[model samples]
Target: MDENQEAWYLWRHVQTQLRVSFGGIVGVDYTALRHVAGILGITLDTAMLHKIQALESVLLKKVK
Candidate 1:
């Protein structure tokens, strides 16, 4: 995928995760994230793992 596609894929998944994990706590759109797995064609754990890896890579870069 292209950069935009990759960024969008990541962003959408992260947004969904945040909305699910923190929607009630932070007022994210809970409804929008309720069906994230169906919408993204990924298991929740798979998406979360990738997001965490992406986060780790960014932090590692900051330490470099």
Candidate 2:
């Protein structure tokens, strides 16, 4: 897959895992997300990390 596609794939899986492991976005911190990404062998670049952070923030806000 292309870089963008790969990033999305990683994001979806990581998000799912965070929800499953932590019981939802409220319990998912960036550190834990990064650790899980590492375990999944996904390398996150600065831009991708920023995007993930932004999305996580949105999710957290919604949960609140």
Candidate 3:
């Protein structure tokens, strides 16, 4: 595939997986999402890392 098409495909793939990962994290825990992503060979981007961290902070606050 061409560079442009390949980039698009990778972008779409990540986007699709991110949806499912976020859904799982929201329903379960952030670690569950990280585990699943690791099993699926997906790496978290900086933005996603920040998001998960933020969610963890929010959840911790709710717990306390």
Best by TM-score: 2
Highest lDDT, which number? Answer: 2
Estimate, for each residue in 1-64, the C-alpha lDDT of model 1 and write its tens digit: 5534543564555553432233233322434444654577744465555654565456445544
lDDT (10s digit) by residue, model 3, range 1-64: 4634432333333332332253243333445566655665656667656655555556545644
In angstroms, how far off is 59's CA in candidate 1? 0.3
The C-alpha TM-scores of every prediction are 0.32, 0.53, 0.40
Where does the lowest 10-residue lDDT sum fall in candidate 1? 19-28
- In candidate 3, position 5 carries an lDDT of 46
Ranking by TM-score: 2, 3, 1
User: Could you tell me how far off, in angstroms, the CA of residue 41 lies in candidate 1 after the best superposition?
Assistant: 22
Q: Tell me each candidate's RMSD, in Å, in order.
A: 7.7, 4.2, 9.6
Q: Report the alpha-carbon TM-score of model 1 versus the true structure.
A: 0.32
What is the Cα-based lDDT of residue 17 in candidate 2? 48
Candidate 2 wrongly placed segments (more than 4 Å): 1-4, 16-27, 39-41
